[model samples]
Target chain A: MNNFLTHIGRYILLMRLVFKQPEKKSIYFRQILIEIEHLGLDSVGIVVFISIFMGAVLAIQMAFNLDTPLVPLYTIGYATRQSVVLEFSPTIISLILAGKVGSRISSEIGTMRVTEQIDALEIMGINPATYLIFPKIIAALFFNPILIMISIIVANMGGWLAGSLTGMVPSGEFIYGLKAFFEGYDVFYSLVKSVVFAFLIVSISGYHGYYTRGGALEVGEASTKGVVNSSIAIIIFNLILTNLLLA
Target chain B: MIEAIEISKSFGDNKVLDNVSVKFEAGRCNLVIGQSGSGKTVLMKCLVGLFEIDEGRGIFGEKVLSRMSFDEMKLVRQEIGMLFQGGALFDSMNVEQNVMFPLSMFTEQSIGERLERANFCLSRVNLENVNKLLPSELSGGMKKRVAIARAIAMNPRYLFCDEPNSGLDPHTANVIDNLIKEITEEYGITTVINTHDMNSVIEIGDRVSFIHEGKLWWQGDRDTILMSDNKELNNFVFATKLTRKIKGL
Candidate 1:
């Protein structure tokens, strides 16, 4: 408990340091662009791949279970849509990202720490936290919602393809169910969760990396811890956000 | 000049540096030498403000280190440069970008101007035509030289090196030491080097501070160090067979 509190306190302090104004705006701006490429754009392939397969799997399962005469065939599409938008795309995709982007941030910064690159920055009068972390946060904040939105679109398309190809449900009925009673608020809720999860993944991983103390082995440990901790935070936050936003 | 006045630092219950005080002269190589755990590196880190001292203070030029706020310390640090043992060049950046990094962050120099200055610094280190190479692409000696270029790119008033020649051939180590000595003399930068390498101590140790068991144990230069009668210092100085043979002990 004491160690946990110490970590919390140190994390808060690090956040304060990380959010300071950049020493040079131009340099920071360049770094943000670079981070957007590294952290955000780089994750697109994995996000799209997972979302498409998951959507297809969810539709297939829904069709298999809801094939009774009492249930409407359109129910498959509706269920798939809800599952993709409200849960899978936003929540599961974020968990995947907590592993991908989270590990990258942790290992990169952890390597820097072990190599004394961070100390080099500090001795140069640069705020190492701000110089290294703020750009990642900004890049994630800016691009994560876009990634989630892409996941939503791509996953819905995958559901359509699965229904059409597998003959689980007719195309017209599936499209109608997809468009049926579509709540704009659900998409908004997913976006909100995405932004929050993005913050958690990047900042928590960065914290782990920033405090890394040893060499290559310790860096690997930090990376693993970062992914684990951020994934847990995502799960917990997903529960809270789903309750708050949906209920 | 840089001064460490009775500075002390401890990690948990392990006292790493205990009331260690020393002065580093400008325009000369100030070498701090001791065994592996003698707190030499800790003392350097404390003086550079990477680790806060539990007691005493550091004075950089006329500024009192312990009294300076974060902002004030940053402003003072603009006059400082450091070379880490591992080089610590930004791995993502090529050599040119690495050297120009501090200038881009701290100066209003145009890109062309920054490039010109970086080129000069690189050339001063006797490296050229490798501007596009990554740190991993360079040899260990080349990496150290690039690190030196980056360190001097800012035209710093002070330079600190922690084990500047830790991993290198004896010939390359001599090159690095002489380079550091030349740069120190040319720029009149207050230079502090933390090294256990005897070659460094004998070659360019304009002044030497010996730390033993977390305490400042002795002070002298290369000439006087060989003849010192201090027992611990003698043990350290004569630990190597070559030095033992030279000292006839």
Candidate 2:
């Protein structure tokens, strides 16, 4: 309990430092662009691939479960839409990113720490935290929701294709059901969740990385911890926000 | 000049530096030497504000470093430059970009101006036409030179080098040592170097401090090192058999 509280306190302190005023706007802006490319553009393929498969699998399972005549054929589309918008797109994709993007941030910072690059920055009178982590967090905030939005669109298309091609449900019914109960608030909720999850993923991973000590073995450990901790934080926040917003 | 006045540092239960004080004068290479684990690096880190000193203060000119707030420290640090043991060049940036980094952060100079300064510093370090190469592509000696170029980019009043010649061949190490001495003299910067290499002490150390077991053990110029009666200093200075034979001990 003591250790946990200390980590939480330290994380909050680090966040404060990360968001402090930067020394140079031009340098910070360049860093933000670089981070956006790494965190957002680079992860597009994997997010798309995973979203499509997740949507397909969910649709197939719903079709299998609701086979009886009591259930309408269009219900598969409704179920897939709800699953993608309410949970899968934001939560699962962020969890995936906790493994992908989170680990990279941790390892990169951890390597910098061990190699004394961070100390070099400090000795140069630069706030290393503000210079390194702030841009990454801002980039994640700007880009993660966009990624989630893309994931939602592609996942729905995947569901439509799977239902129509497999003959599990008529294409017309699937499309109709997708449009039948479309609540704009669900999309809004997803965006909200995505932003929060993005903060958790980037900040938690960055905290782990920034505090890393020792050599290569310790850097590897920090990376693992970054992924695991961010993934756990994403799940916890997902549950809390879901309860508060949609209970 | 940089002055450390009774600075002490510890990590948790282990004390690494104990009430150590030393003055590093300008226009000379002030070398701090010790065996491994003797707290040489810790003292340097404390002086650089990378680690908080447990007690006492470091004075850079008239400013007391330990008493300064974050912003004040940043202002003081603008006049400071450091070269790390491993060069610590930004792995993602090319040599030109790495050298220009300090300028970009601290100066309002145009990109052309920054580029010119970067090129000049690189040339001063005897490296030419390799600005496009990444740090990973450079040899160990080249990396050190690039790091030195980057350190002096802002024309700092004070410079610190932590084991600047570690992991280099003796010839390369001598080259780096002489380069440090030349840069210090040319710029008239107060340069403090942390090193265990005796060759560095002999070559460029105008003034030397020896720390042993977290304590300041001796202070003198390199020429007086062989004549010192300090047992710990002798044990360290003449540890090698060749040096012991030369000292007739």
Candidate 3:
């Protein structure tokens, strides 16, 4: 009972510390720049390409499913809006980010843990958790939303192509579909999922990497665990949010 | 000074260290000698706050490590320098960056100043003109030297080495031992080393503590180690055929 309480207590304390005032401890502007390059800039191409594909798929599916004469022209636009502002943009973007960001976090921290670089930071009076993990969490939080926004835009472009191909809905109708839902709720939902997913992936990967022991074998395990666990958590959370918001 | 009182550690059901206690003083190389699986590393880790003690208190100066707050312990930790068993230099950083890490974090020094100190330490360890090389490029001896340089970059008040001489040839190990001893004296830093090599016990075991089965079996200077009557200590100290022959046993 005590151990369980203590575990919860520690996690709460760490969360508060993580979310509390900005720590000047480990800004590591250099590392931040490197990670931003890796997580944000370098990842843009894949996210954009994936978004286009997702949008195209949604438009094609909607075109095939449409049988009602009254709403036939609205199908591509509605499908594009639903997928971009809600599920596809946030969920898919995060899944892709996990492969890039989460794996890098695991490898970097795992290498540090084994090399004693983390301990070296501690011995120098810097908190390894604060110095190493916090900046990563911050960078992920900072970059994920922006990347998600880009994903949504590219997906809309893809939907336009798919809509134009089917002749079921024109590119103009797809633009109209997006503008119709421009009450900002769709963007809000996407942002919400992106931020939450960012936190989950960065935090879990940090935890896994920080506690890594043993040798090369353990580092490899932590990397695999980081990607698998982060992906699973992202999906589970996505499902819950979709139900709660769209139900 | 550092004192560990009744330190014990275990892994699952197996107890690795049991009620080990001792005091290590400043400006002396205190060697913890034991054979493999004899709990030497556990004790050293317990002293360095790496292994959480099951039941013990580690007192460094006036601070009680077991009773410390996370933040408070971090403050004390700043004064510690450790050379890990595998010469845990960051593979990503060049030698200069590795040595400058602590200074860059904890000091107000400019980059120029940090680099100067890093270069000084590098040269002190007999490394020169190789600061641009990554850890992979360095030989085993050079890696250990770089680790030592990183440990002292902070001008730490205390130093702990886990098997500093483990994988090196005799010449390299002797050089590392002498450098550790010299640094301890020069900086007036308390140094603790964990090792099973009897050769180390003779080289610079200014003060020696013997651990067997997790207990502090004996404590003495290197000069008296060969003459100690304690069977456990004698067995470990004279386990080598060389020592046995000298003792005529």
Candidate 4:
């Protein structure tokens, strides 16, 4: 318990340093754009691919379970929409990113730490945390939700296509079900969760990387730990936000 | 000048540096020579604020580095430049970008001005037309030169190089040594290097401090080192068969 608390405290302190004012606003702005390209643009393909499959699988399963004629076909659409919006797009997709983007951030920073690049920055009078980690967090914060929005849209399209192809539900009925009980608040909740998950993923991974010690073996260990920890944090935060906002 | 007074550091129960005091004067190649694990690197790290000293202080000019807050240290660090052992060039950036990084972070100079300064520093290091090349493409000696170019980009008052010639051939090492000496004399910068290479000690060591087992064992210039009577220093300086042959041992 004490070790856990100490880690939490250290993480908070590191966040403080990460948010400190940058030495050069112009350089920081450029870094943010680069990070966005790395974290958001590069990962879109995988997110879209996984989300589409997830939506198709969920729609098929919903259709299979609601095979009775007593159940309305539109209910499949409603269930798919709810599942994608509430959990799959934001939570599961982010959990996937906890392995992809999170591990990359951790390994990148860990390599820099072991190679003395962070120390080089410090010796040059630049704050390593602010210079290296802040832009990543900011980029993730702005881009993860955008990715989730894309995922939600694409996943719905996938479900619609699967419904049509599988003959699980009529196209008209699926469209009606999607539009029948739309809640604007669900989108808001998703965006909130995505933003929180983005923060956790980047910050936690970056912390693990920045404080890495020893050589190549240790860097590898930090990367593994980074992915594991960020995934766990994303799940925990997802539950907390769900309870707070949608319970 | 950069001065360390009674600087001591330890990692948990293991002491790495103990009451080691030294002064590195400007316009000289100050070398800290020691065996591996002798804490020369730790001492240098302490002087540069990379590691905190457990006792005493490091003074850079009129500023007391040990007591300065992180914000306050930035002011002093701005006047500092360092060449890391592996060069530590940002692998993602090309040579020009790596050299111009410090300027971009600290100076309000226009892009054109920063590029021009970077070009000049690159030329000063005898590297030309390789600005767009990545560090992975450069030779080890070239990487060191580029690191030196980056280190001096700010025209730092104090320059620190940790194992600058660690993994270089004798010819390349001598070239690096001469380059450091020429730069120190030309720019009148206080340059401190941590090295275990005897060749570096003999070639460019204007003021050398030898550390043994976390203690300052001996101090002198290159000429005096050849005749020093300290037992540990003699053992270190004459450890090689080639040196013992020259000494008629």
Q: What is the TM-score of chain B alone in each candidate?
A: 0.98, 0.98, 0.97, 0.97
For every prediction, compared with the true complex, DockQ reads 0.88, 0.88, 0.52, 0.91
| Candidate 3 residue lDDT tens string, A1-247 | 9975774575456566555433344447666776677667888888888989988888878877875777757656876777677888898889888888898888789889987777766666666776677777877888999999998888888888888887867777777776764657778888989999999888877766777898889998998888888899899999998787767
Clashing pairs in 2: none
True-vs-predicted CA distance for residue B65, candidate 4, Å: 0.5
Task: Give stretches of model 4 more than 4 Å off.
Answer: B245-249
Candidate 2 lDDT, tens digit per residue, A22-71? Answer: 99998999999999999999999999999998988888899999999999
* Residue B112 displacement in candidate 2 (angstroms): 0.8
For model 2 the local lDDT of residue B136 reads 98
Per-prediction backbone clash count: 0, 0, 0, 0
lDDT of 2 at B124: 95
Pairs of residues clashing in candidate 3:
none
> Tens digit of lDDT per residue, candidate 4, span A47-143?
9999898888889999999999898999999999999999999999999989999999999999999999999999999999999999999999999
**TM-score of decoy 3:** 0.91
Reproduced native contacts, each prediction? 0.90, 0.86, 0.64, 0.88
- Evaluate candidate 2 and give its CAPRI docking class based on DockQ: high
- Ten-residue stretch with the least lDDT total in model 3 chain B: B42-51
Q: Model 1 — TM-score against the truth? A: 0.98
lDDT of 2 by residue, B1-249 (tens): 999999889999999999999999999999999999999999998998889999999999988999999889898888988999999999999999999999999999999999999999999999999999999999999999999999999999999999999999999999999999999999899999999999999899899999999999999998999799899999999998998888877
Model 1 off-target regions past 4 Å?
Answer: B245-248
